[model samples]
Target: MSHAPQAILARPALLFLVLVMASACASRPGTDTLIPFGATVPGAKLVKLLVATNRSGHEGHSAGSASTRGELRFEELTVSIPPQHQPGEIEWSKTTVRDPLESFVVVERQPMNATDFQERLNSRSNGAGSTGIFVHGYNYNYTESVFRLAQLAADSGSLDVPILFSWPSDGAVAGYVADRDAATYARDDLVTLLETVGSAQTRRRRLLVAHSLGGWLVMEALRQLRLKGRDHTISKFEVALAAPDIDVDVFRKQLEVVGKLNPPLAVLVSTDDRALGVSRRLAGGRQRVGAVDISDPALREAAAKADVRIIDISSVTAADGARHNRFVQFVALQATTVVQADAVTSLQKAGAFVFNAAGNVVSSPFDLASRALSSQ
Candidate 1:
């Protein structure tokens, strides 16, 4: 019959969907704009980061899919943030000529061997407060992940040594399945990086932050560590997953293996995360952990029982339309402000809380009673 006419009409709809997805992922600058301009600009802040990755190409500037061998590489970079930069924003160069005063610019890049990398990390770790390791989500190139970590450190005014663990995301909107596979492939390398960080002979704390698909990789790595009886290494860090893209059932199973830590794991979730909504649909209608409704009594009870702190960040406005990056805004606010003890204590417990628009933490009466009971 005449099904050809129906197929012809559907092409435009598919094209429109492709364009929307491209626009959403193309808002940030790509690796072509990552050329280093050695000159420094006055009034600009410099952020230094240690980066580890499993992607092929030069150590200083590698991206795309993982290397066939899946070997680890290391590099250090210094990025200059413009003085006029706002909190929770990475200002890309508007013109071809990168401007350090108006946008982010790479000032220095150095490649390091494994021994040198570990020694450098140890030097930074000795008695220097906490170290922060950031694992970026899907659709991120090497340059974007590097700059975003630099921006986050500068915006939050954090004193922790910043480290970036860049997995092999091809950085394409249409490469979701490929990126997920790459994330799974990079699990061992992530574990190796964690072991190196944990081996440092110091008493400083460590914070591991993963977003979206990176959350899945992190959970798998932690499960591996638990199976290997590396509890001491796991004890050195606190973990936070923001807008994680793992299926609800999968996350529960992973939690069963990963078990609980000294400070409970923090999961930053938003009900209206459009990116996760798409992921949920792609996963055969299975709910993504990051988009779960925290107000649901059953979900809250499960989270509490698992010693997980689920913080609903739906009240915080996202810089992007997708609402997937609200965690960046939340971190900026939490880092800049001196949160009160009650709010801090509530967050430390296993329950649900809300991050209000005013950058304050709100706890429920049930959580308060739980805290009180735990204190006794």
Candidate 2:
């Protein structure tokens, strides 16, 4: 998700200015100060939108807010003016030098509902439009999630739609259980966020990018959402799970559910993710959901037999030597540009690729592939 440096600079400046204005307008904490939605800020073409997590929680080192006392909840919302860049400005990355493996950012954070989400979608759905919701893995703090997402959004350069849903993560190797439990507790919030943003009213092209434990939460949420609705609501949604930390069998079941909902969605798996491999060892050596082993002969048979798409991204090695963080580290790969272009193209075309048992690129439903593939 590439953006003109000038445009990127303009967004933060505007955000800084808005924060200042909002601070001046509302003297009390937690008061909803409405910033007009769907408006364009100076130097921006697309409307800048944002979803503020008013669900009370501790902001960094600050005293715990009431919202942070229990399961995180989304209470308030707002839509910011659009940034100068188009929707193509959003991106995702696999960080190697960085501690956090992956990240994403939307040029404009919008209100957290189906309606506001739709408005943002309509604004970006023209030529190179897309809508992507990123669910990050465990061991991440809020800042880590936002900044990485911001970079990804910038790198992907897809301006259609960029969203990052950050659950409470302690950013510690030992905090895996705590983070998983927290994500489970927040499952409903995730579902609500997805349904609200991906609903018919919104009608925007949507994708879910999940990593590690976040992958589990994403699959579980989608499974539960489909179970509640009986598979009618998930067909329109797409998913990309990277290095997920889930039991292999659980992942298989989830895949069966997803295949029934949508044709083999993109599942990026890696064999070199050290942390996840350790998790596999802890899980009695059973393969994990997002591991490269998912593409192994036996597993691939299962995947293909179930009509699921498992893309083995293991060839895209981590340049940073950071194991278990392929999503962020793989950004260093030569395919970065291709993947970025494919991202917007996939969104605009509303079709994605499927891999055979051998990990070969099969046929796709992408529209205007030549034009969309060219990084003009």
Candidate 3:
């Protein structure tokens, strides 16, 4: 009789073990393959982005980062829009999702080039006549860059045609030197991309956004464009460099040339940035342009001469580990609000407050943290 009671007790223990194992398996996603964050909201489709990359794609994974700079190619992918998502990681629920960076799943993907992209762009009704190009920085693989551009586009909802210009970055912090050379080699290719876009059947609002080292590429490309007397061929929109990693002295010369284009060039810099500090050290004690305070006498004149407006976001709280790309966070947060498109002018109209060269002070700064994190 005692043996019978012991056996009965063991049955429940076995059942508990099975339940625990089931839960563990359920926790993991269906596929081991990385997917982009969040499922689409009910009755919604995917957010598509067109891509142009100079990185070699014949590697093991077609979407993997290019090992060497290759011929520039065009492709497109679509990302699902997760309803009620905040910037960065999310909780698992109907209203939220798991971290976006964990996996990069896409609803649809296609092979395309500049001509096909233009056709699709012409067909789009939302924010027509606006083409935004995003240049990624160091330490980004190809997949990561594409998904991020998708996230930025979906979140901003301002871009009519979202284009990702991904150069060959070694995708490692230690690979800075290699990335620099790679970016140099890709400079002319960037010009070609720009010219192709410029020659599109329709003229549109051309916006360029470069982050970190990619900002260096933008300056170089613009300088080249100006040198070739080709900068005027394409209509330009507002240019924003978020935590640019360009050398201070070099950036000044770049500003001298690009400023002639005279579309508002906004340098979104933060003094609290730690990544720029490392980049500064790498540049032999020279501070990167993004780390330069707007009040710094050196850059203030350049800003004034170039008609560049300094939006000092050093006061904004950073959720990402590195305080470098605060511009992306700001865009993501703005999407949460009922703000509509035309985001270039939205910065001033949103009453977010801008700081002049008075040492980059935010006049009447409001708490954007709580607002950014609020349940959407």
lDDT of 3 by residue, 154-265 (tens): 6665566788899988765446668889889889888887776666655556677888888899888888887888866534434667788988889877767765543446
Cα lDDT tens digits for candidate 1, 192-296? 999999887665667788899999999999999999999988988778888999999999999999999767888889999888887787677799999999989
Q: Arrange candidates by lDDT, highest first: which order? A: 1, 3, 2
Which candidate has the highest lDDT of all? 1
Report, for every candidate in turn, its global Cα lDDT versus the true structure. Answer: 0.77, 0.51, 0.62
Per-residue error for 139 in candidate 1, Å, reads 0.6
lDDT of 2: 0.51
Alpha-carbon runs more than 4 Å astray in model 3: 1-45, 58-62, 88-104, 125-129, 336-376
Each model's TM-score? Answer: 0.88, 0.63, 0.74
Give a tens-digit lDDT track for model 2, residues 42-121: 54333233332323443323311122314433322222213332222222222322111121222333234545555654
Task: Report the candidate with higher TM-score, 1 versus 2.
Answer: 1
- Tell me which residue pairs clash in candidate 1: none
